[model samples]
Target: MVAADRNAGGIRGQKAVFVGPHQLLRPLGEGGMGQVYLARSPGLRLLAVKVIRPEYAEDPQFQRRFQQEVEAARRVTGFHTPPVVDAEPRGRRPWMATAYLPAPALGEVILRFGTFSEAGVRALGAALAEALAAIHAAGVVHRDLKPGNVLIARDGPRVIDFGISRAFDATHLTRTGMVCGTPGYIAPECIVSASVTSAAADVFSLGCLLVYALTGRTPFGSGEPAQINRRVVYEEPDLSGVPGTLRPLVASCLDKDPARRSTATTLLGALAPVDPGALLSPGLLAELDARERQAEADLAAPQADPPALPVRTWQSLSRRGLFGLGAGLGAGAAAAVGVPLLLTRRTRPTGSAATVGKPVDAWGVDAAGTGSPPAGPEPLWSKPITGMTVDHQLSLLGATPVWWNEGMGAVGYDGTTGRQAWSREDAQFFQVQNDLIYGTSLDFAGLVWLNDKAESHRSPLVVPAAQRDEAAMSLRVFGADSRTVVLARETSLTGGGIVAGADLGSGAVLWQQEITENLAVSLARHQDSMLSGSGSSMGLVADGRCYFEDSGVIHAVDLRTGASRWQATGVTSAGVPSRLLRTGGLLLVVHGLAVVALDPATGQQRWAAPATPQPIFGCALGAGRLLLSGAMGTAYCLDVTTGRGSWHTTVGVTTAADRGADYQAPSAGEGFFGVPLPSRPSGVAVLDAADGAIRWVVNSASDEGRWTTAAKGGTLYCASATTLRAFRAGGA
Candidate 1:
């Protein structure tokens, strides 16, 4: 799929890879020094290649600009900036390539998707501001900052065509009288004099961009160039549609005086908390994916040869498919390092590399509950059901334990007495937050929630249209915080996940991010068969952040808006989730054989965990200590802050684990952790929280085909085909 740049400038009748030599072009600029011609690039071009004719390639001035743009681009690298890939300035036909972005220009998206929500515009502004900051920080000025120059990628906005502008170079721009930037979005100062353009000029353009983003019209109304320039230099911006909250910032960014404009850094600080990833509509996101697929399809069109030493480039495969965005930025923005999460082998290990026979501190957890219980588990209550029993489909909503009864739906029973609380056949419960039980309709197309009183609320989903027959798609809840309940839609378990957050009170989609990375892995790669009690396959939620491991990276997503707060990439996967867990005051990433602790706020590795005797499989956090279990019935406990081993122990049960047994994530809660014995799918080994002591083991009745368990609120719940039993630290 990845072929080198075959000779460009293909036949006139066939698809043109690059504008063939001798092709006629409109004279964009004519001056005393040189003449500039306009050349159009294909939408799906893998690299934003700027090709020049042999005559221009030898020009000292042209070569200088090409080399300068390449150097400037290489200096600027960030989530918002596309990287310079390959360049051949001195070649027969000089050419340079930047990561080709697949998404549409800002103007195109706005035209197709309509004006962004108020919050979305803010996010756009913040992201653009960050891009500007990176560009300026690299000492490069983006002379042209406009809607068309910015690509609204799945993850964030990408400032494109920054330094590399062959046909539209600064020297040519000034002579053409079109100014240094686009007419409507250009700063007044730039129109007045191109030579005076600076970073502040970009900020002015940013303001214009935001106004256009929010209102779908330029701050300076479009008209003849002279007229637009006159309005930009003399008139007050048309801010009627801009949000009142953002008007001030927009106004400041558009300040006529460059010195008076808000710096990108200041804008970043002011808008840092905004979750830009959460504001796009499902249609817009779907279109982004469609654009990528379309670009790939464009590549399939037969290649035509174009003579003249073609700019040689390289391409490799990646999760995104043949283009392999992870290596270099793919068609562009999604190719940024943020796209694919890779496991890093380097680590900032805690204490010292663990010594096998050495003694360390014991691990402990404190799931605050009714009270501290006895040392060992005690049977609480057992109830029999005549029908609808699916082992392990259990969750504790407050003082009630809810189980999924196949076909019939959710069945909830009181935690203390085992009396049936309320059964909802209409929906299946998945998460509980803010004293409310969150669930989805049997088809997973609608959102359903109920307060502790059993009062339920329902709202339809924007995606997964049931009427349209979208059975290939399934929505998974990332849990709800006080403000937003996030759900991610995916075709399958692996990649291309789009997470959207809905308002807690209104059930309206507030925000979402196109995380085309490995969604299933993020959700549960570590634990394949056994899912953590947290509801999803393999993710953790704490302090309003959802942490999950995808490929080799751990991403911390803000629950309020579904924006990624931080990404801890390169974490070599040691074990199953909560692989990306926030516990004991630190974020722990498990990959390979050890867990690494990172600052939850920054994702900076605090330390790598002490080693365990077996490959780590299961993990849980309580108080400030972590508990990780391994096969051969072995487990390790350690202080979260110090990474000091508290105690390591191996309980009974040396039976071989099931295939990919290490992939099954263990369930833990209250004060213990449990893993299936696998002798059958019905037996479980329970471990004490204070120490790695085996609290008790349960074997399913032969009649029960399969059994599953859930540990929550200091109680271990074992469910079979016809009965459910609750166990605690002591006899209830």
Candidate 2:
């Protein structure tokens, strides 16, 4: 199938794969991202593959990130994390192949059978403590730890999902603005930024996970993310039912201060009995048994009244005031490193290295390269483009710079000679545009289609002439192939439409399509398929045929001949969906809880997974392996062939905070990093591509330096905000 036709008129193209139907046995469950399926291997070995939400597969950035995370996950050991058996990152519908261990999550066990007794809790706690220690020893931090992440097997407990966790030596994916972790179990420091460190944060999470294992709830109790974050940051955990003997250890682990929190190693030592026989003595066992029964009874009682959540308020007073007002427990505003700046440059001081030479024209040096600009590297080379500006909320397309001007407009530089090839100024007007540095497009028909930063659609061609009585306006047209810019009086919303034709020399428009006063939000295009969406319904063009929806009916029209094709049933919703994405040879319309994937050849149902309207945390797709996010802290991966649960890992809690936290909350500031270390420098390690084994690691846990990125053939550039650094990768 042609890329455009198979897409059903969407920007993303799907890769086709073959799978046996017998691979998938039974359906495990479903959530926001996709479905989990139970599948068996050819040798009768059990495995699982997760099918991703089609919309997620449509996002290139999300897809790349998902692949990176999955690849990194394979490097983790210590028997806590599940092992990845196989994967296909680039596929029609992505999925991961993992060994399907038949262990139930602690949450599932508790929900189905009831809470664990005191003896069981201690044994589980010891096992988990050891597990976390091993994970940390491997230089990993399990950022999200909860009952769901812990599996109960016949031998012991196994932890899963290193998705949110990072190795001690790497630049964190969460970094500045994104906050990741289960709300109820998140560390106190995690609320501030990604600067928090050491295994102590995991220790705090361990406390919460252990509390849930013993009492079947959070230590700080429940609410939305914002509500629970406050309690995690400030309020003391209520251990009313905890036995006196176990209370001390739990409290120590829950210490808000990392220094005070017990190390995973220390906990393991403390768990060891001076005398194992005395651990089961009659008197002691009876006392422990009574406490366990009481706790179980308490757990069974339905909360007569929901625990009172403190009313949160934004406070700008002193740190003490923030604490006093209970605002310290709230989530801090997501922040970026610097302010946003358009295409412009300011000269540095007289002796600054950046200002040493006269600026040259037409430069494009790989930011992901070695520090020394290579011999004959572009004289117009610049380092750290997007990192220089801070606008974390900037859409994925706007997050990075495309081709920008050193002083004038954008210029293209030759890859080999580092010389200016061509430059364009006033070529096209864009309100917001991010360029794609690593994408290719086929020159087909009279169209030069470019898919940059996922959603931006700008066409230098098809600049429509202005009517005498009309005022020239700038229009924002969104679609596949090309977005038209009309400089005509009162042309359309934002003065834009689909480009019919344009003059390259003068940038003039020859033809255009006029959209009615409907609220159009998304558009998709394929070889033989075209789809667009408005507030109430969808419109499509299949094989030169046109289709529109009004009320609850769909009408088809032939675009080539200007005739109608055929209309079918329409979808009804309160408003337009966020956007349309194509995958698995279909066009997908997605809202919070509803999804519809239609065949591009003919507008027919391929698959429709109704939305459950939950906050999606992370999504990934690989061939037959698919990972889906859950409302709770856990995530499920399944096999698409059999549609069965392969594995599940509790990552982060899905909850949004209502009000902002106090800005005055104490910040360790620069002190959080750069502290002189007494031990060997800790660093991030890259893994071998063929196997998930550590290849090399670059340490950054100290007062001396930080890590950053620049493009290199194999070497990745690492830098701090102020200093440029470099690291080498050993494997492909």
Candidate 3:
């Protein structure tokens, strides 16, 4: 939960910030450990700055061990290692700086592409072996060596996030309850009893990572931490996916008895003389080079304290939703910062849950009113949009429901009957504004617009200076108002991108501005296309100001000029607000369990509101009230205007990783909320919005698998792997 270590009042103490001789630039990311920043030495050399989390730094034993590990890491040297440049383990926040490079990680490559070629895997595996050999030679153990920690640069694979794995060792894992390594790649000894882990633990992790690189799947499979560790401790790996020729070598490294594994030196002897270029495809190489060049160009031209991203992605902050609760595990990621005077304590506020930014005389309470399922009068209709067994996606284009075919375009169904309505394979469904649907072509050369009648036309989406990575362009639609659309072309991972405003109808460019950091793009389950290559939208918009947030800071830009209006900082790094809502006379935003209200024009706080009783996983607002759903099926109702708590209840539900299903904001309607169950047993739990009454519950056919639910107006649409069903208000 430690996001950024904020000492200054807000974002404006920026006369200059530094650690030792390194000048702090912008944030790269944050994790359970601490915030990672992109910095420059007095010599202007780019460096990756890692600031330790307060909780860990505050521990006396941790600070002592951190110094020892830093010293140990400073001794390690190898061709595949990014050398540690500096450290200040006993400072106010305890930080370390390492060499920064423009390489993507093994996991990133697999996600964008697929499996690596055998030769590519061998070359990268060898590079990793060299890194391990050097670390052990320095008498240091890299307890965590998963795909997320290893960087694949133009030179070769470089292992990072070093030395600190044992900063709080096994004894701390017991004293402070720490997790050693990422689930699938963790060595069995590290899990059963951390006392036994050694250089061999690194060897076991390397084996798992190599399997992931070659097969694009973990050898032990992926799931809950305990389940995955159980397999690691007791069962042999499922190496069927690995190349036949390399299976034996990989198996030898994965021996249940850590001491029996091959040494890093032996593996490096085989993997040596690797060709870095062999590990990446030509297309990836081009994209990678372009991104690196962009970063170099940005560094050459220093900004006057411009908002920016990290110079490198050293460690993926998989905790606290830096990427939406599923960072290193995959799914999403983004960071934040607050304004000068707005930062407040993250603990729950004392006001009524129904508290508002300002006093409101009257408001509807439909979100917590007595009600029934929006799509419920029953005789629910079902239809198969396509195949029966692939990962399916569902969203609403106004009242029309659209489902995806993974890589292909999408299909539309009549909301009432689940019957095929109209299909468009040429251009996918994007965003809906003022009853009009907007999308980009498959190649992203033009914009496609569709009317409610399904009639369409194409307009060129002129994106200049955008990088093309094989299938998709880096240009993304920030969002649209009546006349203009906001677009940004990502140039570098350090967040050097170009933003532009264009005429939505003609796609004629109006103005453009170069951005130093990635915008807090407003992304919802179905706001835009679910297609892999289709870019995302910008942050929310209200009162002509496009409100975007990142690093816990909310920024507003004029939609007409693409100019910065104002930045409201002081928001806690507890959690990034998923959606910015415009209700009453305020902008309603929720981060973690806290709900906040800000003035639309000046980004000023009218009045602080109380948060929900538990950590909010999903939420919705209707009839003047906000409904928050937390883990273990706990739900709370608060007045949308005053933030006053009205009701609370627990509707039995599991806290499994259903890939965000159990966390999708509960569907709200006329009189009730429908909480989507995460296939522990696929079902819908309905509760009366008023008084938190348990109305009814209905389970899906066991064979249907996991169900994804969404609501538009008074209708609820739930889609399973093969079938899509529609329901209305009333009984179970």
Candidate 4:
């Protein structure tokens, strides 16, 4: 018996099943032609195996066409094209396998990270040109070259999925009245003639991909296929965001007249001078390497035979954890398969000063100094506070609320009564851990620690002006038991930057390391000018190590001796490590497009949860789940262990009224999690910790500002720019 037949027991109806020697781990996508599976060869190599429908395999004409196209695909081997590795055209289930590139699809990358910078577009254009050159050289026309078919590999962009590709001399297999490629990306000539497709058609598609990469949208706009095709054939392509340097070349390639379009070879010549390194960052490359390693490990795992049962029964069993073979088809996986598995302000006081026992209306005055009307439903108590910005406030468990503003240093409010418990007029709150508050003053002179009673602990450390001018500085506290606090002072020098750690409590300099000086200089120079933003540099203290990022690499130093522990590259794009959270022995960082969880002891990646399309606002880990929120009001919860999504919810639309409001990170506890609603009727949203179901939405006392929430001891605290309100869960 052939491998396909032997594996027939694993087959259950139309659901994907193992074919031949490749095990279909999961379905990548499905279309009219067939289904694509992320499969693994018996030798453990990853392959995107496309299996033709059984009915199609039985048809002699389809079989012949599949074989011909597979041969042509095999002949067009290039560094930019995923090579066809194996095929069985005559098997009971015809399938072809190609080297699987684990990187995200080009479309996915753009959606997650936003449109590419000019340099990125240039790099992508050049790589696509090279791939097209190879395909045309083999006498094949890649009829489909949309963003979805292009994978963003670490070394360069890779063109993939030659599903509709054909040799120049091959007969047309597509039926009449059928389009061969995606509508918006299809060439005008291909749509108009409905007959002839040449190498020039691929060029037009390349131009479309470039436009999409630069603008995060298709050139012709998107809609129903027929409408899009008409627009493609008649309207001029939109080159709005295309960088001026490449506009003319892209416009030429997208010309309606196929003869006027630039050929792949000509386009390659135009892109030959572009440097791929300028377009790719070290962090991105490191992420790619990690992903590749992960893929290898996943492939190496032995496959388990599917039990003989009904599809529904198997699904139920899988959900119950009786079987660990089935992959989740949740939002995370859906988003992945769609692409192949893809601020502040505060203010001063005003209003009536309401104390703990006062009515909600007496809680505070507005900017006008009149008694401000209650904005949301009445809470347990509300009190007005004085500050210009409330962006960096801390509400630690079992501690009073700590609020920080540029104008008002740090103020602590009673957790239950909304009374001012303490105030540090000279320091801006940085972080609160282990019942101790940490902050820095405006003069860059020293760090301060305040206890719950408002007692102060000062560490006199000053940053020189020269170092401050060259590099940015930040301080963080982390350790396994939350006992050790390390101050990470990063100095960006000319060639690279220096990162020095000091014991926060003792004011003792721990260790210092110099990082990619040249990269730091480049990043600093471009951060303010580039649309993709500058690379982030920041640090974290966690799990007995002082962790910091510089020029796309994450470094960890031992807390006891300040010795280097380990250095991992590409954990995140250039950005500050805004949040480092530890829960269940996993250390989580909100970076780039993922909420990455790492093993605290070894710095090994445990899993990454896919965040929303927008950048994450903050994240919290509790109830065995990771909760993430974004500016768009979207929230996602992932199982802590597996990183599979448990649920996702959108609180409300972000409004301009709340633009200047500083929202506190979401906090989880007591079977509930609280998220600050930043829209009209602004308030706090309490969600069931298990499934992210909204329990209630308690409107805030002020509608027009960013508000943040924290939950602990059955009390939910909501802080707006001018007011801090406390509410009891279940409306107390």
Index of the highest-TM-score prediction: 3
Candidate 4 per-residue lDDT, tens place, 1-732, comes to 011223322212112244555666544544344556677776778888776543244445566777888888889978999889898775544678999987867755654455678888888898999999998898778888887688888778999877335421122333223566677788998887667869899999899888888886678874346777999999998899787888999999999998999999899899777778755555566667887896876575556443333332211322111111111111112222111111011112122111111111111111222232233346889888765552345454245766564223677788777788866677655455556656665564666777877887776553465443222233333221233455433231112344555655555566666544233223322211111111122454556677665544566778767687776653543322334556688766555235566777777877766433333556665667767665446566677787666665556555433432333467766676777765666567776666555566766445455576666666777777777787776323
* lDDT tens digits by residue: candidate 1, 528-571: 32234322334556788877654345677777766879986544
Candidate 3 or 4, higher TM-score? 3
Candidate 2 lDDT tens digits, 626-729: 33332322223333334333433222111212001100000001101011111123222232222112223344444222222222233333333332333334
The reply for model 3, stretches above 4 Å from the true place, is 1-377, 388-391, 405-407, 430-436, 465-478, 493-498, 513-538, 572-578, 612-615, 655-662, 703-705, 730-732
In model 1, the runs with Cα more than 4 Å from the true position are 1-378, 389-391, 405-408, 430-436, 442-445, 451-453, 464-473, 491-494, 521-551, 557-564, 572-578, 611-613, 652-671, 700-707, 712-714, 730-732
TM-score for all models, in order of appearance = 0.45, 0.36, 0.54, 0.46
Q: On TM-score, who's better, 1 or 3?
A: 3
Better of 2 and 4 by TM-score: 4
Query: Cα RMSDs of all predictions?
Result: 23.0, 24.7, 13.1, 16.9
Identify the runs in model 2 with alpha carbons over 4 angstroms from their true place: 1-22, 30-35, 51-68, 90-94, 163-178, 195-197, 273-732
Model 1 lowest lDDT segment of ten? 322-331
Which one wins on lDDT?
3
Q: Can you give the lDDT of residue 682 in candidate 3?
A: 67
